[model samples]
Target: MSHGQQTDSERKPQVTVVVVTYQSRNTIGATLDSLRESCDAGLAVVVVDNASNDGTADFVAAHAPWATLVRGQGNIGFGRGCNRGFDLVATPYVLLLNPDAVIAADALTRLLTFMEQNPQVGICGPAVQEPSGELQPTGALPDPWKIMLRPILPGWAERDMRHVVPGERPQATDWVCGSIMLLRWKMIEEIGRFDPRFFLYFEETDLCRRARRAGWEIWTVGEAVAEHVNAASAKATGAHMMWDTIAEHYFRSRFYYLIKHFGWPAAVTAELGELLLMTVRAAGERLRGRSYKSLGLRLRSPILKLPVFPD
Candidate 1:
């Protein structure tokens, strides 16, 4: 590189990356390598291991001695683990990353530049793709109906359709993919921490929802890219069982959100409809020879609760 170019590169803003891992020994190294290539020497990388028996901590320390490893007290879940790492970060901006995700070489700088260009944006997320480079839905405007209808209805019907398309163009979105979200320190300070009530799912949407309500814009930096190994952490434990629990938690959290904002009647209505839909799907899947065990059924009893609100 030319001297002027090298000097300009050296003047880039410093970033602190916080990666939360749970049984990710197989994929963490690749993530670290990608981050190393994307980041400068001054970047502070914090890896919080959620008590993995796979020797994740030692492996990380030995491989990347510069990284600060925080061994989790237990599997405190994703949002909580990220919060733990966030406490240690004092940088102007922080990147919340998953161990199974890899950011492009220019992702950090591009995202940082985008945030710099748009002072109104408090949180920015990059375009996300699967390991195969297929575009993933990285940003969406959060709404109860939109979240519930995405699976039942076609893409055109949903209010947040931009996410379903693949591109490298910036756009305003309700929420960005938590797997690779970048937040300015000022926003994090003003909004407080992520709602730990969402042990696993919906935490990102909740935070982004709050950010939007607080008059901050959330943007998707389409030029920035990250390859995410979807559900890497959830799959580590037990895909079916873990996902079921996450779904239940999501439903409950949804109800909790409704109750807090819209009152109890709405919360009850939302909860009942969610439970009924879950039961029907579970029953259908079980009849397909998927096995009761695969459906989180230990002898045909339902794994979740289902009852009308008054009951």
Candidate 2:
């Protein structure tokens, strides 16, 4: 098996997987289990635990003995955990997969094969789907000025499949969700790793943008698919309080992303827009005599089950 290591005579895996998990006890096993085919082909995998208190590390250690597990002192956050795992790898290609995501059969092989055949491509992502065979929403790269309209018209953000044609080959993409993305080692050596400052969201987008800026093509392979149980780690935390819920992290990360790429003034405007949108959404819900989440999911900020706070 490609366990991230091989003797001189043994064939090595061209790609390694890095999975960062936090409070993912409910879904980590399925994610690992889904890699059976890839693991058999010598695809070494590294699993990082960002201080999961739910015994997630123990489960990975005891259950997935083949995977190299990195336990954290505390919740180092997703980006940092992925960086830690990436530092330990030397494979030509690396995949950063979410603990809540499960790839379809041979999905890793296809993604790795695609990256190997297309050396110009630095980062590639699978077409995300739900376990029930539904196409999950993945967004195109955010436009600095255009994203401001997201608060008013949610669909202003670009769709993930905008560049894709159903029966065609892998197409160029601005960015893909961090849920299941493959990276080139050389790309990292050239452009650096995921921005550690981004605790969770937008870190992958930052990495993708950097790669694009470095003359590396970002792509999405429709043929390579994965089932993402979107935000299972965050849901596992069972945080309901506004400050404790993933919304806090999600919004804070969103703000940082806006400021880093755009500017502080733009980021502030976006935040205020979010507030206005949320208030409008609340008013609509009142008229409907029903409840809806605050500033609900968008192609730009597709958060699942945020539960409208104080629920």
Candidate 3:
């Protein structure tokens, strides 16, 4: 690197990275190390451990003592944990990263530079790939009808299509994957932080939805790349053993997201529509000589039990 380039790099905007962990002992270290390489100066990392019995907090305390660790009172969930870490950040830019995601030093700097250059963009993300190097969905906000159709329709019907990577180019998008997002502090201050009601899923969606409504543009820079281990924390945690409980949280959060934005009528309609679609799918499977094993799981979700308005 030339001396001029090194001096220019030192002038890049400061960034604060917030990583919320839940039984993420297996993955958090690599994530922290990646962040360390992501910047030589002007970076603060906050790790909020949500009562991980797996010694995730202790590991952070012992190994990455340079990071600011906040031990949560309990398993307060992802959004709440991020909020806890966010409170400690005073930088102009904030990066919310998953405990199992990795971004190269150049990629992190590219994202920071992108945001700095495009002042209109409130949030930006890199082109993300799975651990296997397969390109993941850039980003797409799901359609309510498609979410309701699920098994009754094609496989892609309910899949997340929220945002996308621009293929070695930069483009404006509505939102980006929450796994690794670079956010402008001013935009967050104007639109507020992640909604705490979302214990797990849909929190970032909710925040991005608000960002769009607040007239903030979200972008995805394809030149920057990130690797994400999908659901690493969720799978490693006891949540995998306690899937039913986890499913309930997901369904309830989904329901709350639907109702909060689209209102009660849409949610009620969606719940009934989904049940109807599942029934149709089950009948079709039975006629085709296959048993629909997921019927019981869907029924057990108890999405109807969630309130339209917070009680």
Candidate number achieving the greatest TM-score relative to the actual structure: 3
| Candidate 2 structure lDDT | 0.75
Q: lDDT tens digits, residues 185-247, model 3?
A: 999899998888788777888888899889999888998988888754465663442244567
Tens digit per residue, CA lDDT, model 1, 1-311 = 75556564456546789998888889999999987765554677999998898988889999888788998768887788889999888788899888988886677788889988898998988888885556667455444454333333436435455552434677888778788888988888999887776566667777887898889998888788778877644656655533444555555555556555556665565544544545565677678966433223321332223211211
In order, how many clashes per candidate? 0, 1, 9
Candidate 1 stretches greater than 4 Å from native = 1-13, 138-142, 146-159, 164-167, 232-245, 275-311
User: lDDT of model 2 at residue 184?
Assistant: 89
lDDT tens digits, residue span 1-311, model 2: 56787686457677788999888888899999987677877778999998889999999999899999999888877788999998789788888888988885577778878988999999888778765455654446675455555545666554333533223478787777787888889999999988878776778888887888889998888887677876443446753323245555676677777888877778777666666676677688879998755445432343322112111
lDDT of candidate model 3 versus the reference:
0.80
TM-score of each: 0.78, 0.80, 0.87
lDDT of each: 0.72, 0.75, 0.80
